[model samples]
Target: MSGPVDPARIRDAIAQFGRTLGPDVLASCRALFGAQQEALSCAVPAAARDLAYGPHERHRLDLYGAAGEAPKPVLLFVHGGAFVGGDKGDPSDPARWHNGAVGRMAARRGWIGAVMNYRLAPDHPWPAGAQDVGAAVDFLRAHAADHGGDPDRIVIMGTSAGAAHVGGFLRLRPDHADLVRGAILLSGLYGITPLEPKDEEYYGAADSACDKSPLEALASTPLPMMMACAQYDPARFQAEYLGLLQKRLTRHGALPCSMSLPGHNHYTIAMHLGTSDRRLEDSIAEFCDRLFA
Candidate 1:
């Protein structure tokens, strides 16, 4: 194994980009984190790639896990692209680094990591993302043992728009109560704030966004949750994080396991997962272990 990625440098680079989400910012983040992640050589050999979980062209997933005597717990990860785009692994890079590194991280921790891609927006609207999430879960549950995973010990995690989908899945698919053992949400919107134009593209009219929102359902869901947001997340995401915390506290009299990662922005919060910085990855592993235990 190599040394960890320098969190301070990643933090400094993101600080220079300012706290915003856009092409320029996202490109810079991809380049910076991509280089760091690639250098780590952390891509675990995947058991399967581009496996179809649903009929749609975008309904694909990759699985990563080492061979073991006992079936490993499952960790399913959903990537973010503002509801329009994002891939489980970089197609341009055949090595499966970048966002796919998180899957490798899970495999290293003795878990079966499944990274999936779902239908995008404009063509596929609200409930589609959530529906795809359910489909992916169904697929994983059915085929987990075949890929060295325990179907019953499953945790679902998502970042940004992907987090929104996971939240929606929990809300729209009440049956998730038995399928999903826990959830990890990083910087997801929960309708605490009005929808942006891009969000409207996926959620439909601004009027019905609330009805499609996952706030009320998430606050009452029985699934174990570990939530987090970057210190420099865009104001809306930060507010959503705080809003969920407050709602959970009010509704359940306690907050979920959560954190505000400092010296990092929204992108780095997920981007730095496979790097030397163990803050986020360690927390995720600990959370998954507790759920399976």
Candidate 2:
């Protein structure tokens, strides 16, 4: 929808991902998205196309993996758009990009990467996203091995709203808890309040929103967890990050593995996967590898 992004701005954006927060946290996402779209134009292709995970048309995933006879770990990724908008970008599109890049990141690491599409808010909402994540897990457990994925090492990862969904999975789908080997929450809104109307639209009344927030509901989870926020993430995301960390440490007596990417913002925390800025990428890959080991 936009023209080419400035290369310098992209570099500056990546530089900002792992730094301290500043005045420009909310101002840089659009530029970063433009830059990401350009960068994704050159990404490797998905090995599998739209494979349904659930009954909804959007309940689908794309797989990317290298040729391997052995079962590999899996990264089931969810995208963020304030819980309302975003997609598993068409790999065919040279102009727009999405979470598929993260899938490619998984495949490149000798894992099976899956980028998913969940029904959005105001139409399909809070529990819907959570439900979709559970369904994706079921689908993966049922078929990951057929696609060369080790069902035992499946990890759920998300950014922003998607991160909320990932965290919600631990809380919402307790029956499927054993299916998840680890979890990653990147720039997610856990229990940060003053629900924006749009967020309320997905989460329902304020009470419902509070009740559903993983930040408020999750004190301790058995799954290996990690939460990361970019240096330039929005104030609310940073707030939620600190709040979640404090809550977990107070309740569980230990903090989950966490990081603050110095040169990135909320968007780049996940966007930089498979890019030259490998700080967050390396951290996540290490986490997944260690979990499987």
Candidate 3:
């Protein structure tokens, strides 16, 4: 007998549910996001701690770990905030997001979890965010041994706008491929055209801007990637973009593994990362293992 049903239909259903949540959900969540993050931190292992990178007034990274002598693979996480608002600190707000499921789960799995902050849009924008991530990756690789992390086994993971940052890093810094073994792009934006007409002034055009769409960048080199999104995420356009990427990769004989999580909303899909669900995290771990194998 056949197992279950068509994957496309399942994805469509999840998209429908996410749409039903309306735009207000994002707005409300943004309001109380900090508190949620604080509550979430309680789940982190006691050994987990935060660290700063670069010189004074430079970027900082929050590190998490489970107690043990064995070195663990590093998972570098970047949070989503539409390119404008977000921080690695501020546990009082869920919006701050220092201690989410990803952090907690990384600790539980005995992995070195590194979450860092990047420059925001309008002020920094495009290449700035990507550059920060690249710098952080390099910093981690250079110092991973001191922190009980395997520099060569680093994984770049991000959500929404953060995903865009990851994509940009992969495209712009191929020389650092040795540092980034793979990427997990979750609900990321690819093209600037998708921005509302009023928002165009923020990102400018794909032709002139240094932060052109990742899709355009991929024409040159495609990195090993696993892109996924929640079934209920309102950003269905992101899924469409992923489909385009799949086709592009296939045409080049380099398509990366991809998936759309079932019964998960945009927020919840990421939340499930550090949970026992194993649907997303397991796939990520499997990919990492394969990369090393």
Candidate 4:
């Protein structure tokens, strides 16, 4: 196996990607974590933009597709922002992660990649994100063919809070089970206890939290999963990943293929997705590709 990336160089690269030469929003990720370098997700152009999956202001997604390709597998990415704030696209900068970066990577890999935005918390509360995910799936399942995506082959990839929403949808009685072929959960909360006040607010009541915990709910007839965390992630998230891995192993007798993104922390891992760092990307692709095959 290759060694961890040089944190110093990774830090410099992150500043470059954000088009901010000095420390700020993206650069602060490392400083806040006491880690050398955090992840920086870069972006690219979309074949289409601001496509509405639902009527809500936030229920929109961006599509990255190969022109004239009518039938390609789809990778719909759900972003994370603690369930309070996050968007699918960053119209202000190409250096930011969101629709462009991830979608570009998926399109490059010969799949129809997409990034979506959904209602956030405080106002929306628990299950709102999951509901939005369901709507996005429904939209894709019905119309992916019109935009060169094969509705039958769709994978949902979520990070952090987004993973919680994906988890909820996965256990939503498998109604759209056939449409969503696989899932990739990165540094997810998994409904574990001791949530911060902000998380508690967004997730709602304690009883509601129990109902929403992905780790507990995923035991029976869980779909194929890829559970991952970063080397420098917050200790809590690392624990969450390990717990999920153990759950999968004990229940299924085999661990789902997962990884620790070396030289990466929670925020930095997703940024590496569109870059040359293929360790995490390759593992995710392999997992999804096998499902498609």
Candidate 3: Cα lDDT at 283: 82
Over 4 Å off, model 1: 1-5, 39-43, 91-96
Tens digits of lDDT, candidate 1, 1-293: 12555656667888887677787777777776676666544455667889999999999999888658999999999998899988898534833465677787788788998999999988999889999999999998999889889999999999999999999999988888799799999999987888988899899989877789998888999789999999889899999999999989998898999989987788778877866778888888888889998
Question: All candidates' lDDT scores?
Answer: 0.85, 0.78, 0.65, 0.73
What is the descending TM-score order?
1, 2, 4, 3
Error of 3 at 279 (Å): 1.8
Summarize candidate 3's per-residue lDDT along 1-30 as a digit string, tens digits.
023334354344455545554346554433
Give the candidate number with the greatest TM-score: 1
Minimum summed lDDT over a 10-residue window in model 2 is located at 18-27
In the predicted model 4, the residue pairs found to clash are 39-268, 41-271
Question: What is the Å distance of residue 57 in model 3 from its true position?
Answer: 4.8
- lDDT for 139 (candidate 1): 98
For all predicted structures, in order, the TM-scores are 0.94, 0.87, 0.78, 0.85
Best by lDDT: 1
- Whichever of 1 and 4 has more TM-score, that candidate is 1
